[model samples]
Target: MARDGLAAHYQGEDIAERILSALRAAQGADARVTAEVLAPLDHFHGRGLAATTEMAARLDPQADDRILDIGSGIGGPARWLAERFGCHVTGLDLMPSFCRAAEALNAAVGLSARVRILQGSALDLPFPAASFDHAYSQNVLMNIADKARFFTEAFRVLKPGGLFAVSCVGAGPGGEPFYPVPWASTPAESFLATPEETRRLVLDAGFDLVRFEDRTEAMLPARRRMLEEVERDGLPALGWHVFMGAERSLELVANTVRSDLAGRLTTLELLARRPG
Candidate 1:
């Protein structure tokens, strides 16, 4: 998909306002805005905040570290990291709406000083070489067609020995995934690579692999439960559906689980380091 087309896929009007309204409704109108309070609603990927928590553990950020959050939707993980680790986080994404929402939410949670939001592409990071101590991306690779450039740019921006933790949905052996998944509405917007290709791209980018896991089997049970819950009671009040639209979001999430169960989708978690 073209850059504009890709941006359009995730675009929404009054995104920040809508999310804030939902938050206030879920909690009390005067409830204090904090990262933990926003946890259930802000993380826009599969498994939500739990996935971000796991990725942070792998990155092992220090209080003084400068971290990059590639494809940070609404700055959930970035704010969470900044609050928990006292690290500085720069969140980059392709959608202008998302960047605006991220910045607004950062201020809402009193994390504007610690978290910065930028609207940009993963394939072309707007930074100097060796700029950050570590980097991470979650569920963002499926939209990027040039996987090589994505990995290469990440490698370029990280300081030597900096860790990069990435978790994404890869192509499974069982044909193609069902359409209308969370990341894409159709195959035109989705660009999934096999596990072998993903590993090769990371290695080719000069990153020494620290850990790589095919988490498909390990995560299937949880995914099934999520699907069942959605089917049983519909989406919760405070969730990604607030911005993505409840009905469309339901279709997207259901197809994701269907694809996974049918072996058309696979999840991967990778930890790599720029060699010293």
Candidate 2:
């Protein structure tokens, strides 16, 4: 049911081809393709690539690590990590279109050898036990109704000493968030857990929590700056709006920021290690 909701929310056709056309237009048809050029279009969460940068710092990936990207959309961060750290990345997305698009983008960036894309559910990750050295997901948990299963699957796929990092939107202290947020339209499609419940689920999943922070305060300045940038420059020619729809994308971003400020929504950054 949750998967169906997410698929419905993110469903699109020919996402890869459209993004390729965007890239070609932006950088010229024959120009070199890189994750740097694609970041704006493929970074589909709050604060865009900046959030990925901070997550990467926390992840501290090594050159040869086998990293799993949960809910990797079009392989942006997967390619980025593979490019920046020379690591092998396998990305899983619930939407087949996203997985297909990820493959096409990986091919475009010449990271096909390092980044693999698969279509699967986070609740039941298709990989075998101890399949990954490290793993992470960004802004992908809110759509999920089963937080415990998500963490358990993450734990199962990771090596004993593997670490799983995540950045998620948590339910805030106030009442419900506004409708038409990024993850869902009405309350039926969204499943936001409070910070306390989020932590407890991770612990129950057998991961020793290394760090957990409500990054709402930290994200405020960046969030505001982004709104200003949008007001000043409007939407960029190249962005995820191609898939998410321009007006809807803009509204969702602005609404997310508004909810954050209103204490209706908060972001959480977490790091947990499967006990060695």
Measured by TM-score, the strongest candidate is 1
Q: What would the per-residue lDDT of candidate 2 be over residues 75-129, giving only the tens digit for each residue?
A: 8999999999999999998888889889988988899999999888888898999
Per-residue CA lDDT of model 1 for 177-250, tens digit only, reads 99889998778889999888999999999999999999999889998998999999999888888998899999
Clashes of each: 0, 0
lDDT of each: 0.91, 0.88
| TM-score of each candidate structure, all chains considered together | 0.98, 0.94
Model 1 Cα shift for residue 17 (angstroms): 1.1
Q: What TM-score, to 2 decimals, does candidate 1 have?
A: 0.98
Top candidate when judged by lDDT against the true structure: 1
* lDDT of candidate model 1 versus the reference: 0.91
**What TM-score does prediction 2 earn?**
0.94
